[model samples]
Target: MSPSTQRITVGELAARFLEQCGVRAAFGVISIHNMPILDAFHTRQKIRFVSARGEAGACNMADAYARVSGTLGVCVTSTGTGCGNAAGAMVEAITAGTPLLHLTGQIESPFLDRDLGYIHEHPAQLAMLKSVGKDAFRIRNPETALATLREAVRLAQTPPCGPVSIEIPIDVQKMKLDLPADLSPLAVPPVQPNLAAVDQLAERLLSAKRPLLWLGGGARGASAAAQRLVKMGWAVVSSVQGRGIVPEDHPASLGSYNLQKPAEEFYETVDALLAVGTRLRSNETLNYKLKLPATRYRIDANALAHNRGYTSELFVHGDAEITLNALADRLEGRMQIDPKLAADVKRARAEAASLVDGTLGQYVKLKNTLAEVVGKNLWWVRDITLSNSMWGNRAPVLDHPRAGVHALGGGIGQGLAMGVGVAVADAEHQLGRRTVSLCGDGGFMLNVGELACAAQEKANVVFLVMNDQRYGVIKNIQDDIYGSRHAYVELHTPDFAQLCASLQVPHFKLADPATTRDTLQKALAHGNGPVVVEVDMNAWGPFAVKFAGPPKKKEEA
Candidate 1:
């Protein structure tokens, strides 16, 4: 056979395919069932394999890598339990609509359906994966393995993107097969928008005196179009996952302070609501009870996403970037925006910022310190902590869509792993940025073992642990609803400085409220690896607003 048509193991071919797709790094644990694939990766040395301590952390890393780098994030895992370990992180990727390719191993082909209880056997493994992933595929033969891999990547990168899982039996991965002479990755074409619908929406937008644009994670790719709309005097707000679609500092951008009082007051005056590429999820909209404008319209790539939460007056099924561009073109010179509406947006934003500052109290100082040190070079990654729920999600102004990563699924303990992934991917892309993951004491301890992985990889990440010595949110809930009878919320935290010393990672503690800024600056300026910065939340005192109680209902309003 010619060199171009040489036979190679399926595992090697898979690695080569990933490399051709421009994948620079992958994350996962090594196991016997997946030895062939991992061996190939090690031998080629073309792609860096981040050895994570757990499958869940690996998946989180892959998800964040995809978000920060704007590429297909690759993750590999072994059979059965290994794949099960990644299920939670897969849910997060699904919620955030991250483009991720999860490669996993399966039992031998002969034992696949027998339920013989093999060492790594699992009942209905493929079905379980299919339920969690956007799509799941199993490679039954070596000859078609490469094609299957390409299809999985294509699907993950398509519009309405999410994670895709592919499993190859151990025998299949080791099988030798002849690859096609022209084995290149396939490029998926972008979806187009309907021009007629765009014109109709443009006309509606032009007719409204006070219109607002709501951006979601899916709108990240359409930042230019969003900016154009904002420039036309349409005020903007974002869902938590949708932060940074428009730089939060923009006069028209409201950030994630949508459910607050000042923003709610501004919403009262809005006549038109143009939502693009967002689910308008209940949590962000205060359980879908936040009062919006009377005339509502939505543009989404997924046709099924229409009317998922709150129903819109007009639902346009199309790609957000394309639709916005078409709408902007149609409304070119025929639009006139009210000056009063612009002034109102600016005033409302200032008021909201002040309120958040007052609520944050001592944490407000930390936030400003971060902005001063990192400026726009920081990638704000957060776990589900009180600090994040209260301020981190909305307070910071991310200059770019890729600069913010959060646990959209509302899960904790994934932030450290995600931050490491973001840092590594950013370094690979030469973005020259630092990833700061804000975690609570409880969340940080959940996957604290992953700190070793960060040390090993020397990932440029700062893990800021807000040590309240307990589940602050849960405690607040008990105080409000259960008359201060707290149970199972108190937690014991390790001396983070000592823990970091054991891992050979830099460590800092912010025990003094007055020295908070200096301590944070020193931690962030540390070497290119994971650093643990523990903030004494107790010293900072209580927050002005408690976010633990049940969301206020629309009927109450």
Candidate 2:
């Protein structure tokens, strides 16, 4: 065949387009619907495809991969049931605002949107995808497949970024088209700030003595600008997603302890509060009832974010990086910053640490032990569990923006798969970093099959399963608020050692609190592949203070 006759199928176009856009890895479960695209990936051998046990696991893996790698994480799935299976994970990505691309197969063009019974057909699948993600698209014409993919990626990486999905029909995937000459990535223009608005914010903050900066998920890309603000005597506090934006070890960094008594009290004294790219979510703000500084300013790419969470005195519409750098440029050496602000921040941080330390009980040892072993560089991934709620979120203190990954949407059972994604991204970037997924027995069991996937990929991850033989948080809530009448919280505990043996993965059990360090070390030393370290929470006992549920206003409590 002549060179002009060698037309490319949509499957091959997707493969080549992703590679051109710098996508080094993708996660998915292979099925007949998506076999064509997977075949292209296999034939090209450019993007590393991670085969997860389930669609949920695959999407969760992609979410975590984007978080760790700071790239466009990709996931592929079959049509109908398979696409629906990925919705929960897609919601998590949307909540975290991760830049991810989800590609799923669809039924044949002839059978499209028909109510008649057909295999792998979901009537309104595109609507479902749009509901769970930032945006969703369907490739109706084979000729526009590449353009649709490019637009999806552009939207996913745009400011206020989130996951975007594209559904291509199996028949369309097989249709041949002339390859586009240009495969370069789409260019998304930054949301530039209004200089007048930025100047007004700078002027208002110029007289402030105690200025505070609240960083959130949207500010992750502006770490360098945030650091400059810190150097200029701004005290830093972050939401969970914003941890490490200013290096938690910095004396002025509050490190997600924003709602702790010490930090809340400190907020009252702050004369100026500059909230950057944060939603000030209910979880972190006591459902919007927490008192904040009287004078507040907010910068965000999403204009709607201005007055939704906590009303700001001035709202600057722009990307976090651009607005922050512009603010720093205007305020440098001009503001009347307090000389003792750093000391005040240090005192607040110390008090917050003390408050958390008093509630760890025997697990304080576990927290400290893990800190010593994992140090600051290890990638910390967590699910919603008793352990993470207690200490896992703020323990070791991450130093880089990408060093932390967690279910920002408060989902359970995503950590195990997220760990696999983190490990894959680590390998692809040759970062040589180890990942530890902190999960509860209940959540771990939810995605237990993914452990096999981790083992198969030889992912560098340690699954730290905190086994309490129940849904500890639900039980705690029931005890505190429901007259101690436990219902379905208790679960039949599994023998993790036996389970690990079946998967040929190394396992270690830490029943004694004293063995926390040793067990973690041993698991970490199993460097070749995944390892499971089960912390016997039942044997070890309860925390010093019970976290029944999220903190609420005094009236709600």
Best by TM-score: 2
TM-score of each: 0.97, 0.98
- For model 2, give the RMSD to the true fold: 1.2
Stretches of candidate 2 off by over 4 Å are 1-5
Model 2 is weakest, by summed lDDT over 10 consecutive residues, at 1-10
| Superposed Cα deviation of residue 285, candidate 2 (Å) | 0.6
The C-alpha RMSD of each candidate to the native structure, in angstroms, is 1.6, 1.2
Candidate 1 error regions (>4 Å): 1-4, 554-557
**Residue 498, model 1, lDDT:** 85
lDDT of 1 by residue, 141-205 (tens): 98789889989999998878999999999999999988656667788776676777777787777
lDDT of 1 at 492: 83
Give the best candidate by lDDT: 2
The per-residue C-alpha lDDT of model 1 at residue 550 equals 35
lDDT of 2 at 323: 91
